[model samples]
Target chain A: MDLFIAIFTGTIIAATPLIFAALGELVVEKSGVLNLGIEGMMLVGAAVGVWVSYAGLPMPLAIMSAAAAGALASLLFGVLALTFLTNQYAAGLSLAIFGTGVSAFIGKGFGSAPLDALIPLEIPFLTEIPVIGPLFFNYDPLVYFSFIMFGLISWFLYKTKAGLVVRTIGESPESSHAIGYPVIKIRYLAVMFGGAMAGLGGAYLSLAYTPLWVENMTAGKGWISLALVVFAAWRPARVLFGAWLFGSMTIFQLQGQALGISLPSEVLSSLPYIATIVVLVIISRNWQFLALNFPTSLAKPFRPAE
Target chain B: MRFQIERRVEPSSFMRFAAPVYATFSTLVVGSIMFALLGHNPADTLFAFFITPLMTINGISEWLLKASPLILIGCGLAIGFRANVWNIGAEGQLVIGAVCASGVGLFYPDPESALLLPLMVIAGMAGGMAWAAIPAFLRARMNTNEILVTLMMTYIATLLLSLLVHGPWRDPDGYNYPQTALLPDAALFELFDPMYRLNTSIFITIVAVFAMWFFTERSFFGYKMSVGGAAPLAARYAGFKQSGSIWMGLLISGGVAGIAGMAEAAGPLGQLSAQISPGYGFAAIIVAFIGRLHAVGIVLGGLLLSLLYLGGEAVQLSLGLPSALTSIFQGMLLFFLLASDFLIFYRFTPFPKPIKSGVT
Candidate 1:
């Protein structure tokens, strides 16, 4: 029972960053823009988050600054993909490379600087309960933010008219524009929102997860989150579930010995990436399902007919 | 009052070449501003970063030495890029190639065997092809996205290399350093000059460059693959198999990158270590694009990009700047290059052009 609770808690903690990133990407893709620079945005966010914290600001302010930095970074992608009308993939890629360089350049001296990790919040009433309360309630504020975002986003995506507009634009930007929807303007907003959420995810890393600034430290989580979107079939709820699955794969590395597994550490470390490929293969093999759920306009550049 | 972008009846041939030069100029302008922000004399820093490294024979030799791998990989990447096959995992392929070549160099019965170098080169190519084949097979057979898959494979490849070096491949005689023993004499490349690290291995890249140029510019097979990229539906309608080109594009690039890895391991490095590539794979993407996916262009791009690397190292030593400044410049160069390509096919016209539509 203790072990079960521990794994559940660990999975939730691990899934927090993915939740923020994948969910954000869900909205971005729904709005018909594919931003492959999430990894770069996350790194920028992580570095900026740490820098803000080092400025002796409160945790919330630092996170907010990180989100702003990420949004600003996304603007570069927007200008290329939306305005100048470059290939979306190449534009996003350039943004990723740009983010990587800028983050590393700015993060020069903050690598070994002291970090103040976000403390887990334990509600007073929930603290007295046994396994269930500790399992569900005891987590850093970011975890709770992820859960709240999940519900809010689900509601926004399914119940709101603006969400319908975003979805319609994703499916057919021309038709949406014919119907008087501002496709380019809305896409820019969605991309920025995705960037901001990716930033928040980065904040979860440096401000809570490892609470440190390391160059390229996000490793490949940003890419994994992208796979998570495909694995989820662009659904918010499935994104959470997929995040947990990848989270378990990651925890396998930390808990391999505890689980009585003796695989090589390098192999163990690669489990999450391997699992992502496997999931993509399984999910992507169904062409009909993909065509049904995948955004038709995703990654395709839209130039508003002037 | 407003402007409209009109495609030129024919794209200016001059702009096709001028865009890169303009991008380079813009990159320098941005770099100068960045240097000023960092409180350095922009002119001095720029010179130290770009020109100081080529003032001596040793520097020139080292530049070519560093450029060989980049040129080799860049040429390979250019072929794939032309065919719309994004094999960004060349770094991983390079690592695996090095490991495979080193494996042969380390375990061969006759360390001084004359066949070792040839065998190592073959093994390196095969290893790279094998690694790249995963994404190729998946994309061709399963309809998977090669970009993400190749990238994921890169991560896995890095772990695989780490495992080998940390475990079975670690030098047993050497104190706990995470590297292998020095390779045997026959496994290493013969040097062109004793005073320089540049070796006979450059001939491999020289041959590859001409071959690549001929194949991409002149060959029927190359034409078919490019047609596949330029218009997949049209190619399919014309009876070209998409999978064939995908397989070829990936395999050729992977094999070339593998040779580059073998060069590093057998030439200057002479052993496998934790860090083998200085991002030759990723940087080669920029080189391919900057070179306009042409042979001559790639050579120039490779030389220019290699100079950027040397500049990074030089500035770090002479100006007390961080080595990562090179990455910043690289990213900026690509960004500017892609942005400047707007000039190639389109020009701004007055919004009231319809009122004067017959003016031209």
Candidate 2:
């Protein structure tokens, strides 16, 4: 039971960053722009967040700084795709490369440096509940924050007029333009929103999960988030489930290794990524489903005719 | 005075041919600004990064050694990309190839069998093709997004590689480091002089480039791929099975990438290890694009990118710069290239009067 609690705790912490990132991407894709630079942005955010925290800033401030850094990096992507009418794929890839370099350069002095771990808050009566208490009530602030963001994003995407406009832009930018909506500006905002979320997710990794900065520490989580967006069929509720699923796989591999399971540690270590691919293959197996589900103008550059 | 707006004329062929040179020069100018911002000596850093690395014997060999995989992988990728069939999982294919070849190489650990080397290379090619076929299969049968599929496969390959190195492939004699024992000399191929640290994989790379040129320029299949990329609808109407192009593109490219992987494991690293590639598969994507997906052009891009890799390392050692500076430069170059590509296709115009007053 103790081991189960520990494993459950670790899984929530591990899944928090992924949840944050995938949720961010979910919103971005819901708005119809695919930002492959999520990895780069998250990495930059991690570095910035770590560096700011190291400078003796408050942890909350440090988190915000990380989001700002991610937003700035993503804005560069927006300029390329939305303003310059460049290929989103190419622009996204470039941002990834650029963000990686910039973050690595800035983060040189900070690798593996220790910081304060995020402390978990225990609810009084709920904390005493057998299995449910530990699982739901006791977790770092970030874990709870991810769920809040999930709910808020789900509401904003489904229940708001602005959300509908954003969806319209994603579905058909030209028509949105015809309807007097600012397609580019909406996408730009959506991209930045996604970037901020990705950055916070990265900050969670450095400041909470690993509790230290490392070069390229995001380690393809951003890409996994992109895949998660697809896996969830671009829905917010699905994003949470997908993130938890991946989080379980990540923790399961480590737990298996610790328990002296027969499988190779390396294979187990690689299981999350392998699981990501397997899930992608499974979800993408139905081309008709993907085609029917995808936002029609998701990655298409939007240019208002002069 | 009225502003006269004449459409910009297409530059002459000579200027068109020299566009990359101009882009490179512009990139350098931008790079200089980056260096200045970092408070570094631009001239010294640029000279150290670009000129100093190529001026020494060891440096030259290192450059060639690194260039080998990029060239091989780039050649295959260029061919596939030209046909508009992206096989971005070359890294995965490369790892799989190395894994298969190494598997064969491991069983026959002694430096003895005459037929061992050729057999390993064949095994590598087969391994690469098999990995590449996954996305090809999905695209052909399910009409899945190959880009996402191929990209996702890369992570899977990285994990699988890690598993092998850490688990079953871990060297018994060595400490707990996740790596296998070095292959015996008999299993190794002599590509370059061992004394100088040069390997024979460089030669293989050169031959592959020329072969790629011939295949693309002369072969019937090559024409099919070109037509397919240029106009998929037209090609389909012409009865060219899209599936055939996908398979050929994935297989041939995977085979080349596999050989590159095999070469690195057999010729240099001589064992299966976790860090067999330092994002070479992803880097090759940049190489393929910079080369404009042309056979001969890919060779030039490969050499340039290899220089960037070497220079990045040199800067890290000499200037105390972070190793990621190389990735930054590569990313910047790609960003600039995409910008250039946009300018080539569409002319930018100033915003007209607002349809409605909501936009800022």
Query: Local distance difference test, per candidate?
Result: 0.89, 0.83
Model 2, B219-244: lDDT tens digits are 98898889998899999898888888
Best by lDDT: 1
Candidate 2 has a DockQ of 0.65
Whole-structure CA lDDT of model 1? 0.89
Where does candidate 1 clash, by residue pair? none
Task: Give me the displacement of residue B32 in model 1, in angstroms.
Answer: 0.4
lDDT at position B246, candidate 1: 84
Candidate 1 structure quality by residue, lDDT tens digits, A234-273: 9899999999998888888777888889999999899988
Supply fnat for every model shown.
Answer: 0.66, 0.73
lDDT of 1 by residue, B1-360 (tens): 898798778878898899889989999999999899999999999999999999999999999999999889899888887778989889889988998999999999999899999999999999999989998999899988888888898899889989988898899987878889889999999998889999999999999999999999899989988898889889989998888888998998899888899899999898999888888888888888899999999999999999999999999999989888888888888888888787787788887635545656
Task: Score every model by TM-score.
Answer: 0.97, 0.92
**All predictions: root-mean-square deviation over Cα?**
2.0, 3.9
lDDT of 2 by residue, A1-306 (tens): 877877877777777888888888877887789888999999999999999998998999999999999999999898888876776877888888788888888898875657976677778899889889987788878888899998898888789988888877889899988988988888999999989999999999988888888888887788888888888888888888888788887776668856667775556666777777778878877767777758899887777865
In model 2, pairs of residues that clash are A266-B163, A267-B163, B191-B199, B191-B200, B192-B199, B192-B200
Best by TM-score: 1
| Candidate 2 chain B minimal-lDDT segment of 10 residues | B1-10
